[model samples]
Target: MAAAGWAPPRLPGFILTERLGTGTYATVYKAYRKTDTREVVAIKCVSKRSLNRASVENLLTEIEILKTIRHPHIVELKDFQWDSDHIYLIMEFCAGGDLSRFIRMRRILPEKVARIFLQQLACALKFLHDHNISHLDLKPQNILLSTPENPQLKLADFGFAQYMSPWDEKHVLRGSPLYMAPEMVCCQQYDARVDLWSVGVILYEALFGRPPFASRSFAELEEKIRSDRAIETDLVVEAVKKDQEGDASAALSLYCKALEYFVPALYYESDARRKEAIRAKVGQYISRAEELKALVTSSSKSLLQQGNPARELLREMAKDKPRLCAALDVASAAIAKEEEGKDDNDTLKLYQHSLGELLLLLAAEPAGRRRELLHAEIQALMARAEYLKDQMKMREAQSMGKEALAEPVRSTCTLQ
Candidate 1:
């Protein structure tokens, strides 16, 4: 039923380059867009004959969800088309392959690495949950890596995903058994929390090289999950302790990790109390990094003044602040514009990393007389960030108001 090894000679603007993989009902290929600077994309070609009515609905559902949601950690659906015989879904090409393949190449990842991946996963899940979508199927095979060297993950494959509500009573049995929550395995009602449980399982496997429940049989797996058997792991905590003692580089890295976890919560979260809680965490991560960076900066400055051997490298590091701040200011301004909402996540991430670097530089400045100047600069940056945030809120409000106004017009026209 799949369109395996069936690449058409002429597919409009796309030139099929190579076959990436074959699934049950479709074949994914690397393709180049002829009209757009030959940009590459992963195209999934599915045979129309392969899908029944239910299967077609599922395929459309996936497309609709991708069209509605936009987040950095989610795989992008570049374009899609349907002819008489086939349906093609053009997606972002992830070079590093799937998470499952990554794990196979390296038996187990380090805690710090796993923490970064987990944070990205959490961000994607949080964004989906905010929109009331439940990704019933959450597994390593569905997590695609953007690059191998500096890994960035994008959550893909929404075949079993569905809209969910907090008060919904229906429970459907879906998802892979190995990573499935106990509620799903037991046919009990579940909500968005199931995704969090899957993340926990993934984190455990990433840290320990194996899942907590690695049963040979389905019965055994169900029993393990039902019995509430677990393994305790504190790799993140251990890694954080070590990082806390390190120099500026480690501190800067930690700050990025913190933002990985914080940014999604800050943007998607709705509850006032919960937002305050997340903000406290954000403050804690930033504060610790700033403190550690100050010490590193002061020591380096002292050595540089004495004509230390590593003076050149220290000098380069010191000069990075203003350049980073300038770039951040541009990103912040982009966030203030209504038309740039689609790229807000990327801009926010750039701004966040730059802010962290700027704060590090401020902490490192050893001149007691120049301390107030650095503090004022940091304050100005903070003020700009706050202003951008307010701008985003205003944009959202205006958008909603426009929609509200349009609704009445549509209703009146319909009545006429």
Candidate 2:
């Protein structure tokens, strides 16, 4: 049931300022910590009455996952408390809203922008898979944008994320129908690859403005998914093929490559081999890029369309002005040289160079002026740097996919 028009119950030491959003099991609110200089956070309140046995089990599982995992792209859980009637979770506030709303508003994001978001998603998923955790619900709705200015993306909503042992089998069929993987639709014992499939669907949606597979009803959606149809790849191919034209095109191409790398192999008989290849490629890319990818896509009509004044201002600040121009030159050279080879050591060196320059830029300003101007500038630069890093990673991932295609086929058939 909805909580009295989306208003969260007030709690001690935390003031509920505004309702953030609501879901089936909980109502999220924007709250300020009174004891910590009014630091803002997102609070999710799940009523005991709203959670069934399975939901409670899920909540516990989420707690376990959150407690054990830590990463820049993952949402941070700060604290949790339970009253007689409900459970409360305090989390970092993502000012930019969820990816679903962003997509609906933007219609579709540029392929380059979408790829940046996907790379981050993949890195986060890779971490989760490595730990044997499957985020059963892997849709745009659960991906939150960290800030409009910085465009950082983070995954949220662990209600359907489950811990899977290496030897265990997954049989539960849950998640939005349009995004469900083939194995999940068939109710077969699946694995972490199912999440990869979901990532493919979401990535497709990010570029095309619609889900890869869609039907009017649940049955039809399931039927479509099981049919193993490959959506038209033309848009992505076109975006990538035009890379020679400019920065935007090159960015788009990298994103297309990342999408191609993670696409589910269900439609292709060579899926298992391809997945292995992708895994190896992802590792190589991660090593080369020296940073995880994170992409944020907002509705085209939102701030993206409004024109980024902060970004524009920074660009102007760096223009032909010799001194500022030199810094840009140094930063660009370091990034370019760092990505010159696929060697892991070279990649780390490049990451360090870029990171140092970034930190230096942040430190250049005096403390008094730092908070208002320098902080925003540094965030923008970091976000842009992150985008470039992801593009390189995308290329590496595609290279791996190509290598997989060259490998001998291996049977992935298994009994549940």
Candidate 3:
């Protein structure tokens, strides 16, 4: 939420509860969907007059890009409306406020906290960049948190966003000067890599409470930005090296950085062999990170569950049935290990939802080894679910038994 101290505006279908903030061209409000009270959303209201040609084009681009994307770290655009006077964009509400406000309130986040947000941001950026979308304005203010304590950050405010291919050249200069990449300031043609530079700046600021470059004047800022060799990943590189020297925690910490760097490298690399080499490195790092995290956290169960990279690769390859089976195998193992004995309602509900998802995927998969695997996995999950239900019922009966036994003694005590 950017600082908008304006009066709350009204929309027909939404009940605006609080004014979130205002941007240059729009005001945002926390609103409830009238038809579905449980649905909370942020409605960005912009007057038609506020949009010039460029602004209108930007709005369209944002809508186009957002409509196609579905990632946890990216803010979901639920719906939009164009009225006679204004356009309203309904988005998922971030209860924790924007990253800028969070930083100002807390000064600086701890390393682990910063890493979680940064990792998620990197993932969001990877997804966007993969789809040829560039979120040019990558700053704390444009990043929103799902909650203050939980802190699931969502990328927001895509007004300066652009869709550029590897060969395309972008001459326009936009975004906050403080966080702008050197290439952006130099008027050089840039691609998704510029977003990566902004990620570095944000990460630095999160750790140190200030951006990498601080200048008194715009001219000085531009000079500093252009002169800086590259966004410093020295800290990350050092962490990785330390991890190789046998630091489990450091290894866990550097996992996302490895992933972050790997994404852009893999996406930009034209040579197939080189890309595969990078993929192997990323896979090894991630697998090691999971192992190290498990070692660091001494729990009965593994702290980090394994995700099937093979399945993900297959999905990317569009090998549908094989991907489905891979997904089912992963989920089945996790469920069997984690929820076999748990009878809690919430846990059961979650397992049921997961099984339902697998069922849907299974339906789409063609008949073969993949379909057979899905069927077997689904049956196993169903059996586990029933066993859990039986456990719950037994507990309930035991509780009732105790209550019944106590009733006779209570009556005798009252008579006495």
**Best lDDT among the predictions, by candidate number:** 3
Which model is ahead, 1 or 2, in terms of lDDT?
2
Who wins the TM-score comparison?
2
TM-score of each: 0.54, 0.58, 0.54
Give the clash count for each candidate: 0, 6, 0
| Worst 10-residue lDDT window, candidate 1 | 404-413
Error of 1 at 241 (Å): 29
Candidate 2 C-alpha lDDT tens digits along 1-416: 23566656867888887788878989898888988478989989998998889988989998888878887788989989888888999898999999988989988888788989999999998888888888889999999999976588899988889887556777887787788888888778887778888998898788778897767997887776655334444444554454334435344445445545344342244555445545554344333222223222222114323433564455565564455445545545544553463554454455456557656666665565323554664554455455456555566655555555555555545312
lDDT at residue 177 of model 2 (Cα atoms): 77
Per-residue alpha-carbon lDDT of candidate 1 for residues 100-138, written as tens digits (9 for 90 to 100): 888878888877899899999999998998898988788
TM-score of candidate 3 on Cα atoms, chains taken together: 0.54
Candidate with more favorable, higher lDDT: 2 or 3: 3
Those runs of model 3 whose alpha carbons end farther than 4 Å from true positions after fitting are 1-5, 36-38, 227-416
Candidate 2: where is the Cα deviation over 4 Å? 1-4, 228-416
Question: Residue-wise lDDT of candidate 3 within 156-255, one digit each (tens)?
Answer: 9888888877567787898998888888877787766788889988987887677878778879888776552333344446667878788765555556
Q: In model 3, which residue pairs have backbone atoms overlapping below 3 Å?
A: none
For each candidate in the order shown, give its overall lDDT on alpha carbons: 0.68, 0.69, 0.72
